[model samples]
Target: MGFKKHLSSLKSYEAGKPIELVIRDYGIRQKDIIKLASNENPLGTSKKVIKAIKKEAKNSYRYPDDSMFELKKSLAKKYKVDSKNIIIGQGSDQIIELLVQATCGSEDKILTSSLTFAMYEIYASHNQAKVLKTKDGVHNADQFIEIYQKSKPNLVFLCIPNNPLGDCLDRSEVYRILDSISSDTIVALDCAYGEFAAYKDKNKEIKPKEIIKKYKNCIYLGTFSKLYGLGGLRIGYGIADSNFIEMLSKLRAPFNITNLSLKAAIIALEDSTFLKNSLKNNFKEMKVYEDFAKSKNIDFIESYTNFITFMLPKSIDSSSLCEYLLKQGVIIRDLKSYGINAIRITIGLREQNKTTIKLIDKYLKR
Candidate 1:
């Protein structure tokens, strides 16, 4: 059996360690484990969304509405865009794959931040396209503009409030980079954590309606996983001009979303009370992490998202620290794979935060 030569160089995305696996590895009780590795909503799922999912469970035997009528309508109203401007995917990830498939071929290039989402590079490789990154660890408009002019990549991905790093560029800065690119180059603004950023600082908000209305080459990607407590549901959407949406829609498979996911996402959109309380708790707990970092003289990024990335000192290895915590049944993301000596932890519940902090303090003292 022959596989593409490039497939050998590709690596699978290493997700956050699951609790069952942790239990098997460390012999820890399930209730004792604290998982802050994935940037999932600490508040858990909304009651309204749960009710909708329960109601829709009976209909799971039937195929989903491929048109995605209800979910799109809800998203459209929220973003103030037309239903024609939207396309649904399993997650923003599938949409990313669709964009690469629709626009790229061998030797074509995709430009993005040096230390952003891993999927951007993985998907580009699937199409045998080259991936270019900024010299900086995070997104720099100046660096992006320079690279865009030099590489003229077929697609550019901007991960706002970037994952594993937690830094963001303002709308004006993002637009400056966009302004420099030619109309033919497609740009993807991935704001999966946008709701958290917007709640913290208005300037960080990347409005989908404003983006779609302004640039035909641009598309806005959002997900229900981060803030809506729907990572398990795998429902996400993309917003672009009607023409672009139509083009991507052509590549999407029918019934890509499940019945329960579609129903949950629609109700999740309307569950503003859950969203508000989650945001409040996120920032409140985020401060605890910040204070802990400062007390320990550990440097960390000021996060707009629900998680914070702590840049470990030269004395502390990221993998070593993560392993120590994992053995104790506490899980968090280690950025060693991203070539950084850092750990990205989701802002968990108050008790979870305190437990993790005390454990970190113990690690440092040891």
Candidate 2:
């Protein structure tokens, strides 16, 4: 077995467990399992997008438009960017892998926050790039610049309103970090939660084209998985200068996105009604988790994203709390793998959110 020595140690990215798996494992009825683990749109995929997907499914025999011309044009219009600046991927996961494959030599390094997305490290490991990560839970641009200066990594990643923890830093802070870092380094900002982030009073807006044009080395990543309720479709993209996009395009697989996913993404993008409602629900329901945490004296990191990660009281073990919720047929994410003893729950529908909190409280009382 002459597999690359580094590949053996790389762990696959663990996704939030789906409801079907949870139901089967725990012998719970399907409807009874309230899955608040993944930061998915609890309102569900748009009817318009579903219709588009079904309509396009008949054309699956033919390969996807290899150029993905129309979809890119739609995204370009949506972001006010030129089509050449956009590169769609099967998911943001592929874009990250493509970045690592394109830039990292065996001896180069990839850097990110210690507990941000894991795919950055997983992909870098394949190239045998030394993955350097800062220990801060939140993104502090100055701190990242300090680490980057010492390490001089070839690729850098920042997950906005970062995964699991949901902490965020605004564009001004991002600009500071970009200015301090070596201009030659490729900085990838994973804005997977940007839509949820767009409406905030502060730290809400980022001009990706402007950022890329000024920095020249930045790739801004976006996804339809969260707000668009298209996780099952597997569509995501990156925006950067045309030159950078052209370089990365060489490494991307042909027909990287499926036909149905592409069509649905276009429909989802055009459906302003669905997008508005998803954002509205996320902003309103997220506060309930915050208020409930305070009332229960449960410690939590403040979040701008659709999920809230809160810690159980010291008297209660994290696993026990999770298990209690599991028995009650409520599924959520545990952050032990992220090295934090907390639970991250998506802002589900009002009833689901109510049930999750009530059962958690009942478990505490027991």
Candidate 3:
């Protein structure tokens, strides 16, 4: 049997370690495990979203509203955009796939930060498109502009407050890059962690409507997985010019989103008390990680997201540290694959954070 030639070049994405896997391998009790690996909401699902999902569970037998009208309309009113400007996906990840399918071909190129999300390259590779990264490990507008001028990639991904490593490109820096790129290049501005950034600093908010109105080529990607605690539901969206939204929608399979997911996301958007409490607790807990790093004199990025990345000292091996933590029933991300000797941990609940800190201290001291 033969596969597509390009499939040989891609490696499967390694997600966070699952608790059940740890239980089997390390023989740890399920109740003892904590996962700070995937940047999931530590608060768990919101009460409002849970109730809505339960109410909609009986309707799961029927197909979802393929149009996704209500959810898009809800998102539109919140962002002050028209319904046509929005497109829903299984997750913002699916929208990434749709954008790649619509814009990329074997002859095309996709550009992104050197240390950003892995899926941009993975999806681009599925189409055999060339992937280009900035020379700088972190997102630098100057480097992006230089690379864009040289490669003229068909798609550009800007992961705002980027995943794995949580620093962000400022609003001004983002505009500068958008200004430099040609309208022919479709830029996917992924704001998966935008809520955390906005909570920390009002100036850091990436306004989807503002960007869409200013740049016809720009598409803003957002997810319920982060702040909304809807990772399990997997509902996300893309906001762009109605014209671009139409083009992407044509590539989408009918009913890609489930009925329960639609209900959960619609209510998730309106659960203001949950949203506010989650954000407040997020930053409040984030400080614990920051201070922990400072106390150890470890170098860490000034994160604008819910997670923090700690650049370990030469004596601390990221993989070894992660393995040690795994045995103790704690799960966190290792960035060696990202070509960095660091670890990324989600800002968990107070007790989870305390247990993680205690375990790390034990490891470092050992």
Candidate 4:
């Protein structure tokens, strides 16, 4: 049997190790593990979300509302956009896939930074398309525009407050690309880390709805997995012009979101006090990471979101550090596959944050 050639070369996404998996591998007790790897809410799921999940679990046998009307309505009200402007997916990942499928085909090129999300490349290449990766970890407007004009990619994927690295693009850079790009070139803006961003650095953050409105061709992708602590629930959404939403929704799998997830996300959104406290905790903890890294003389990005990326020294191997941390029952993301010699650590709970700092300090000394 013949398979698509792209299937042979595509690299799969490596997620942060789960607590159970790490415990089994390291012979550590469940209570002893510190998981500051996935940028999940250190607070865990909200109590209101848990209550809603329990109530909605009984309806799991039934499919979610095919239209996802209520969820979209709630999101629309919060974001102050019409429901028609939004699209729901299993996660921002699924939306990425659909965007690639909807716009790209054989030989069509996609543009993104070299060290950004892997899924953009995975999905684009799976469709037998090309990816134009920029040279730097940070997005440079002039360089990207030069490439965009030359590559004239069918799609562009930009991760705001980029993953693993936690760096963001300048608004001028964003506008430069958006304004210069062809109307037909669809730009998919992954705002997965946007919620934490606005609180820390409002100037660098992109306002999804406003940007989408300004650049009618841009699509804004968001996820409840990180800030909402619903990774297990897999709820995410996209916002664009009505026509763009309609086009992408056509490619979305029917009833893509689950009943329990829908309810949990809705309740989670309403729990403003939980959201406020979580943001406050994250703000405080990011400083802990910064101060700790500074004391160690470690090169680390002052992250805009819930994580920090420490550049692995030339003398140190990233994989080795990761293995040592894992065995010590602490987990953080390694960035080897993206060709970066670095490790990304999520700003976990206060205790978890302290534990991770201790582990890294020991690793450095050893």
Query: Weakest 10 consecutive residues, lDDT, candidate 1?
Result: 1-10
> Can you give the TM-score per candidate against the true fold?
0.99, 0.97, 0.98, 0.97
Candidate 1, residues 1-366, lDDT tens digits: the string is 599888898888989999999999899999999999999898899998898888889997999888989989999999999999999999899999999999889969999899999999988888898889999987799999999998799999999989879999998999999899999999999999999889999999999989988899999999999999999999899999999998899999988999999999999989999999999999999999999899889999989888999999999999999999999989999999999899999999999999999998899999
Candidate 3: RMSD to truth: 0.9
Query: Model 4: runs farther than 4 Å from truth?
Result: none
lDDT of each: 0.93, 0.87, 0.92, 0.86
For model 1, what is the alpha-carbon lDDT of residue 17? 93
Candidate 1 segments whose C-alpha is farther than 4 A from its true place:
none
* Lowest lDDT block of 10, candidate 3: 1-10
> Model 3: residues >4 Å from true position, as ranges?
none
How well is each residue in 1-366 modelled by candidate 2, as lDDT tens digits? Answer: 998787777888778777788677888999888988878899899999898888888999999998999999999998888999999998898999999999897889988898888888888888888888887877878779888999899999988879878888887888888888777899998989887776764565667878778978999999999888998889999999999999999998898889999999999999999889988988788888899889988988877788988966668777778778887788888877877778889999999999998988887788
Output the better candidate (1/2) by TM-score.
1
RMSD of each: 0.8, 1.3, 0.9, 1.2
lDDT of 4 at 126: 85
Model 2 RMSD in angstroms: 1.3
**lDDT (0-100) at residue 177 of candidate 4?**
79
